[model samples]
Target: MLMQIEALLEHIEFLLIAGIVLVLAILALEHKDLVYAVFFFGIMASFVAGFFLLLEAPFVAGMQIAVYTGGISVLIIFGVLLLPIFHDTTRERFETIRKKRLGIVLSIFVIILSGSLVFLFTWPTEIPAVNVDLAQSLEGLAQWLWGNHGIYVQFIAIIILTSLIGSLAILKLEKAEHLNPESGVYGLATWDDDTSEKAKAGNKSEDTVPVIMAQDAEEEGT
Candidate 1:
C-alpha cells in the first residue's frame, strides 16, 4: 500500500510538472509580441529548472535558472522595452515562409536529437545506488567550479553585466536625444510671447496699408 501510494504521488508530480512546462511553452509560442514571448520563455525556463531540481541536478538547475531565466530573459526584455516595437499600433507581421520552414526544421531536429540522446543514454544506464552523499557532491562541485571552471564563470558574469550596462546606456542616450533641442529628435520650437505679438502687429500694419492703397485706387478711378 505504501509503495502504491508513493508511485501515485510520483505520477501526480510528474503530470503537474509536465503540464506547467507545456503551458509555458505554448504561451511563449502563441504570444505575438516579443515582450510577452520573452516573459513566457522565462517562465518556461524557470519551470524547467525546477524540473532539474526534482531530478537531483542542483548545479545544472541553478545554472538554468540563473543564466537562461535570469540573465538571458532579462536582457531580451530590456532590449524589447528599449526598442520602438512595443509602441507599434498595427498588427504584428506573421512569420515569413522562410522562418516558418526553419522553425519546422528545427522542431524536427530537436525531436530527433532528443530521441537519439535518450536512446543512447538510457540503454547503458547502470542503476546507480540511491545513496546520494549530499555533502560530498556539493563539495566536489564547489571545488570544480572554483578551481577549473572559475574563469568561465567570471567571463559569463562579465558578459551579462556588460549587456545590462549597454542597454541602460542606449536607453539613456535615446531619452537625452529626445529631450535635447539641438538634437531635433522630439524637441518642439517654442515661440515667446514677444515674437508672437510682433508677428500680429506686423500683420495689422500690412492690412492697413492694403486698405489705404485700395481706397486711393478707387478714388482715382472715380
Candidate 2:
C-alpha cells in the first residue's frame, strides 16, 4: 500500500514539473519584457536539468545547468546590457509581431518545417551491445582528430567563429538600420520601390494643393 502511494506521489510530482515547464516555455516566448523572458528561459533550463537529474543522468544534468541555464543566460543578459537601447528608460521599442492571419499561416509553415526536421532526426531502432574500452576509445578519438578528422574540425571551428562574427555584425548593422532606416534597402514597413515612389508623389501633390489654395486666396483678395 505504501509503495503504491509513493508511486502515485512520484507521478504527481512529474506531472506538476511538466506543467511548470510548459508554463515557463510559454512565458519565455510570450513575455513582454525581454529580461523577464530570459529569466523564465533560465528557470526552464534549470528545471530541465533537474528533470535530467531525476532520470539519473547527472553528467547531462550538470551540463544543462552549467551551459544552458547559466552560461547562455549570462551571455544573453550581457549582450542586452551592452546594447544602449536596453538602457534607455523610455524605450518605445517593443517586439514587432506579425498580423494574426500572417502568424497563423507562419505557424502552419513552422509545423510543416518542424515535422520535416523531426523526420530527419534518425532514432536508433536497436541498441547494439558492444564492449567499450575507455583508453582505446580515447586513443582512437585523438588519432582521428590528428588525422582525417583534424581538417574537418578546423573547418568547423572556422565556420563557428565566422558565424559568431557574422551574427555580431548583423546585430550591430540591424540596430543601425533601425536608427537610420533610410540608410538601408529596407524600411520598417519595407515598402517596395514603386510603392515608395508613389507615396512620394502623393506627398508632393498634397503639398502643392496647399500652396495652390493659398495662391488662389491671395489672387481673390487682390
Candidate 3:
C-alpha cells in the first residue's frame, strides 16, 4: 500500500510538471514580447531539468539548469536587451503578424505530430545489462569533452562572438542609414549643439575684446 501510494504521488508530480512545461512552451512561442518569451523559455528549461531528475539523471539535470536555464537563456535575454532596435516602435504592425500566426500554427501541429509518433512507436522497455562505474564514466566523459573536442568548443565560442559583433555592426549601419538618407552614413564631423555654442562664444569673446580695447584707448586719450 505504501509503495502504491508513492507511485501514485510520483504520477501526480509528473502530470503537474508536464502541464506546466506545456503551458510555458506555448507561452514562450506565442508571446509578443521577446523578453517575456525568453523568460518563459528559461522556466520551461528548468522544468525539463526537473524531468531529468525524475529519470534519475542528476548530472544531466544539473547541466541542463546550468547550461540552458542559467547560461544560454541569460545570453539570449542580454542580446535582446542590448539590441539597438529593441525599442523601435515605428515598425508596421501588419508586417510580421502573418509570420507569427503561421509559426504558432506550425508549432502546434508539430507538437501534435510528435505526440502521435510517441504514442504509436513502441519504445524499448528492457534495461540493457551493463556494469557501469559512475566515477570512471564521468572521468572519461570529461576527458572526451575537454581533451578531444576542445577545439570544437572553442570554435563555437568564436562563432558566438562573431555573431554578436556582426549584429552590433548591422544595427549601427541601420542607424546611420536612418540618420543620413542621402549619404547613407552618419557624419561624425557634424557640429553638435555644444560645438556650435563654443564657436559662438569664441567669436563673441574676440569681438568684445576689440571693443573693450577701443574703449580703454578712448579713455587714455581723454
List the candidates' TM-scores in order: 0.56, 0.47, 0.56
- Per lDDT, the best of the predicted structures is 3
Deviating ranges (above 4 Å) for candidate 3? 84-105, 124-222
Between candidates 2 and 3, the one scoring higher on TM-score is 3
Candidate 1 ranges with C-alpha deviation above 4 Å: 1-4, 85-106, 113-127, 148-151, 154-222
lDDT-superior candidate, 1 or 2: 1
lDDT of each candidate versus the true structure: 0.73, 0.71, 0.75
Tens digits of per-residue lDDT, candidate 3, 11-75, equal 89899999999999989877877788889999999999988767655677889999999999999
Q: Between which residue pairs do clashes occur in model 2?
A: none
